[model samples]
Target: MVVLVLTACPAGLRGHLTRWLLEVSPGVFVGQISARVRDLMWARVLELSKDGRAIMVFHADTEQGLAFRVHRHDWQVVDVDGLSLMLRPHEVGGQSELRPGWSSVARARRARRRK
Candidate 1:
């Protein structure tokens, strides 16, 4: 099985994907396809996406039973201890900062003790 998520891509790209994959939701596509076809589709996405971003997740025989491919996305895939993981960037400028939702709601009580 393959899952593809696209963001900010052209409408034609999404329409093109629907031929082989089901558009379960807007910008989200899923289907079972051969590796050759999947690769071709990914190439097509990269060609047509322009300034957009896309992520593809597919079943594999690895430790995680899945693999990922990302294009023009801030989050990245990394290998750690023979495992694949998504690395979330810590800093926030154009992107939102990574913070615990609970503590982010308001100033943490612990901050008062720092002074």
Candidate 2:
């Protein structure tokens, strides 16, 4: 199995980037993504550099798994394979530190809203 870390500048871009990644690679991918939709915007801004372009990063492999760093600016691909091992969630200590920033409070609020 392979693990990846996906991040976006703003919450809106995160969704688009996630969708793009899912559209590109279907079943081989699994992760969490969060973004806000205003019901008007449909695309994401993937800035590779300071030049303003969308960038996506992931890890891929056939037997040993591969790491990829993509620069959406000029469409550059850098492969870093056999560099490191993918860390499992359980191995990372526990769920105590899982909540970052305001996520925990936000989750509680969302739960209340749902109820």
Number of the top candidate by TM-score?
1
TM-scores of the models, in the order given: 0.83, 0.25
Give me the overall lDDT of model 2: 0.38
Model 2 worst lDDT window (10 residues):
35-44
The sequence of per-residue lDDT tens digits that candidate 2 reaches over residues 1-115 is: 1222333344444445465334334212343343233111223343422343433333344344444433333334433464544332342444553554467787888788888
lDDT of 1 by residue, 1-115 (tens): 9999999999999999999999999999999999999999999999999999999999999999999999999899999997889998887686557454456443555565556
Alpha-carbon deviation at 87 in model 2, angstroms = 15
Per-prediction CA RMSD (Å):
3.1, 15.6
Displacement of residue 64 (Cα, Å) in model 2 is: 3.3
Which pairs clash in model 1? Answer: none
Best by lDDT: 1
